[model samples]
Target: MQPPTTITRVLVIGAGAMGSQIALTAALAGHTTIVQDIAQGRLDAAAAQLRESTDKMVKSGKLAEEQARRAHDRLEFSTDLEAVAAAADFVIEAATERLEIKKAIFARLGELAPPHAILATNSSTIGSSAVAGASGRPGQVCNLHFFNPVLVMECVEVVRHAGTSQATVDTTVELARSLGKTPVLINHEVPGFVANRLMGAVQKEALALLAGGVASMEDIDATARMALRHPMGPFELMDLVGLDVVDYIAQATYAATGNPADAPDESVAALVRAGKLGRKSGTGWYSYSR
Candidate 1:
């Protein structure tokens, strides 16, 4: 399969969990992928992860050695955002989920990237139009939001904000197909798009139950496992997602909707305050070594 002409070389900003996964997926799809982060340590980690991840695919017989090598060969890592963005055909911002920070990043991207290049964000919320509003070229900016564990989850929500042009959204969906991901075209800039909003509703219900003393952690988990058939319960997912991220999403949703109750249950605030930010921090509702 050939990559879309507009996204043959992808620049993934902030090469952390989701960012590195984007790099791996694009490279595997035969696109030149450059992953840039703020720090050298993160770049090193992403490179190592890319190698290991592709090598695992090869060993597991999912990818041949040559194909895995090609994927690894197409990946580049850097700490300089401007340098890479300037050369990229597509730029995906997977940075911190702050409106100001993302706005600032896109502002730089609009200035650095070619005017025709697609500039998309992997933002789950905070709205693409708002991010593009701060950019110099709003037409090139739209939401190319990918689900977590980007390699595993095939869903990519192609969000076209009021400011986004039809071309941008069309090319983004093409890009998603190039990477072998399924794209769901959404014409409006709804907060959390479709998936997150649905999950948020269920999450609110779960948290309310916990807050209302409807169930303990164990009971709720068991119920989800036995009855709901969910791979993991809401609290388990909360812990895996990191309380800080949950807080960020909740706040963004609340601000987008102006619903005070849009935020996650009060327990998450207490968890964030205590610095139990979940998997990345090794604890949230539980502790572990990763």
Candidate 2:
């Protein structure tokens, strides 16, 4: 356990959609962030997207051009994994949510990264302990589960495994604050942590209602928006989060609790199978012309 020191150089591995947003947040927080991806196109696209997001903030008068420039200055894109792993003070792995892929990254990272560097994963539902178990340095590992649209969201789930040290956990929470995110600590290793579990429950109920012909999708959405004052109903929210994510959560939840409630509703599986992968893929329960 090291003291709660400032994160000097942050490395974000895997410049996917979420990874890009995370790297932008870290860079805007004034830390040197190296964003890397296995594919050159992904790295380039993520870098471009980060620039666009920050530029929008600049145009909105939230940040001065010089500040934006400085923030962008802190972010560098690379296809080189070894370089980033060796130099980062803190590394956030945002690769695909597959366990095998994550394990492979951590195994390589365990060999490459400095001993003092803290490793974090952006996994929403996977057990931090399982991920850390493959890390080989579980004592220096923890979960830094950032909510999507990380550049705008303010909450992070700070999770620790059995072997995670108090120092590593504290340093991560402190870093979360520094990045302007509220950190919620989890005492036990639960799949989906806190947010995803609650969200999955709500959506599963919504799906059961739909499947039972209780109401049409529009009617349910209207009820949530008007009666509950929710920005979006279950289906809409599910679309925003991506069907793949919800499916992952449900599977993890059922595995963790052995509860039928956590089982994936047939409707969700159908949507994913149809390649209606939600907003990013252009459709889900809602139609997106773009």
Candidate 3:
């Protein structure tokens, strides 16, 4: 199937940090964006976050005041998924990282959204290949992996599954470009895509180093920042991304490939089990003043 010449109406499922930021970007790109989550509380929080993000961008001079205002104005938050999906020209699912959850969402989106609408997943590790069949429109289903703090991250991976059509990929690439992002096309689906896969190697080593008591977290982090010139160390980035998120990505990759190297570090599992999720939870690898 051919993609619509333009995707002007977008529905984003889930209104968490990543989802809200993605909706904001789409709105800023002049699309009428709807953000839907199951809970009214999440939708309300997402709305508040959207305002804060747009206001921050304007104040920081990253975005013009008028454009920021318009972007916020274009965003609509809702708890009614079916109603929002019906009107969308494109649907992006940024829900939980569970395969079953995503498949269920895709099934519902397939049944509710317009047949011509493009279905995309913003999964960091679990590729669309696993969920596209649930959409029953696999050719239109692809992965549009946007990094955290979506506004600041310029790279977006446009991943094509075996069934994803070239038209869908082209349209997704154009959509990413329209949002002022650099889109890298992944001709075939892979666990963790590209960026995360590379990061995974670093994270694995970081975990191994810590597990072996080679250095303290601070020392390792300083080495990465001061010597390697990385903006943040693996542990710091994990704290920001949330240890749970990092753990989930690692586990997903391990589950798909059955590679022991993809398994999350024991320390990460211990943290998650103890409810030290990360920045949002006030602690993970590091503590936060909440």
Cα lDDT of all candidates, in order? 0.84, 0.86, 0.90
Local accuracy of candidate 3 as per-residue lDDT tens digits, 130-223: 9999998999999999998898899999999898998898889999999989999998778889999988888888888988899988888889
Prediction-by-prediction clash tally = 0, 0, 0
lDDT order, best first, reads 3, 2, 1
Colliding residue pairs in candidate 1:
none
Model 1: residue 254 alpha-carbon error in angstroms? 1.6
- Model 2 residue runs over 4 Å out of place are 1-4
Model 3 residue 134 lDDT score: 91
- Of candidate 2, the 10-residue stretch with the lowest lDDT total is 1-10
Query: Which residue pairs come into collision in candidate 2?
Result: none
TM accuracy, model 3: 0.95
Q: How accurate locally is residue 79 in candidate 2, as Cα lDDT from 0 to 100?
A: 85
Cα miss at 167, model 2 (Å)? 0.7
